[model samples]
Target: MIRVALVGNAGIGSQDHQNSMYRPAFERHPRFELVDTAEEAEVLSIAVPLAERGTAVADAIRAGKHVLADKPLAATLAEATEIERLAAAHGVVVVPAHHQRFGAALRSAIAAVRAGRVGLPWNVQCDFVVAGGDPAPTGELVNFGLYPVDVLRALLGLEVHRVHATGTPDLVTLLLDHEHGVTSTVVCGRVPALRDVPPGGLAVHRYRISGSHGVLAVDARKPALQVRTTDTFGPVWTGPGTVDVLLDVLAAGIAAGRAALGPHDAVQAQRVIEAAQRSMAVGQPVAIGQPVETGE
Candidate 1:
């Protein structure tokens, strides 16, 4: 059994109306035991607010605990690099919660695409808007856009080459150019909390992909696809009914042992978001990991 501790997300404050996405998902789950503090656990599940994210993960690493942190692992690429550095130095695994990789609908869509349903995806579009949730403590691009950014990454399987963004932090639109001549347009927004939707819940979340043969698209599908990365996670679908599919990925990773912690989607998402911010500031398309020919 993997011993775990919670660093934040005690109240399930905002974003996604279910408590199961947080600490509640582990209450009776097998091979997983929750402890009272970080010192007592093998891993730290961090869902803290955006500002405290870096500190929380760093502390967890300093304590020799692995980390499963929520999105936007850090506000900027620099901070993300520092976290990576610290994790490497401390010899701990840190996996960011870019859970779209595990969702059933997106996976189905991806499977179809790979099966030649959409032959060589040419263009993509996605929009993610969070209508309410404590007024969003950070920029719309970082806090809300991370999901769609990750979705785009999963669909394209390529790193963003460049980014162009417009509109205020309250409502922003991004144009991302990826490797191999593929591109994705993204929109991220924030409005007042809706009385109808769950507090801090999503108002509009959507995706579309057009390829050489056909098209692929998706929206929110809460269920996680049952996955076993060779020997990573087992049949998680057989677990408790209340476990959020996203958190299920976390549970499986812990169960798989340290080497099972995989991918750096959060850091990649951070890179794209920061590129978008630079685009917004300079009113130009910013190249990621490449210099934009801004011809001063």
Candidate 2:
């Protein structure tokens, strides 16, 4: 059996090893075991706060354990870089738990895009909106808005070239330019009231990728995807539960002695996020994919 230790005790951590997210799958699988601490496992899944990720991962690596760290790897690029360097020095794999990358609907959409079914993606629009929740400890942008941005980046297989961001406590808007000439606008917010049918429910994340030939839209809240063509719209494609898929991937990567999200890739994503924050602060466009001064 592949021994796994869950590092946090709150929120996601509470459900980490219990299979609360995917009880059936965990119950059926005989190769995985969830333990309470890193001392008892060969793999560690760190689902703690962003500020704590680097330390948690470093500890696991120092113990000769592989890690599956939750996304936004660290609160800042410097911390992420340090984590990457440490993991490399120890020869341990550190995968980011970017669950959206494993979503079936997203996979199907990317396949269609790659197959020329969409005819060259030019513009992408995405939104992740939710109802009110308690104030996030990490603030709104990092707490909820990061998901759509991360998913968009992963689906496009393009690095962010620049970003223009603006936001209030309840809403955040980002216009991102990608390396492949693809431009995207992402909106994330928590609106006060829910519409009748609900414009998009709380916890709802959606995206529309438009190309020369057609458009594909994914409604992640319903956990379904739809492809629209000039002639007709296709059927909805359902996806697996997000948490379960993430855990399974983590387990598999650990068993194989590798990380699903490489250190460099995770750091790159963190840089983009930091750039977005800078854009929000300066009220101007920020260029990405280039070196910026980061405090070590």
lDDT of each: 0.70, 0.69
| Candidate 2 collision pairs | 130-202
Model 1 earns a TM-score of 0.80
Candidate with maximal lDDT = 1
Which tens-of-lDDT digit does each residue in 1-296 have in candidate 2?
A: 86777676333222232233333444445666776667888777676756676777778888888776766667777777887887778877787766665667776776777787878889899887776544455556665555676677667778788998887746788899998789999887777644332323355667899999998887665554555768654434466666567667666666676655576777767776678788988999998865544433
Please provide TM-scores, in order, for all candidate models, with all chains considered together: 0.80, 0.81
Q: What's model 2's TM-score?
A: 0.81
- lDDT tens digits, residues 67-109, model 1? 8776667656766767777777777778776665555666667
Give model 2 RMSD, 1 decimal: 6.0
Clashes of each: 2, 1
Model 2: lowest-lDDT 10 consecutive positions: 10-19
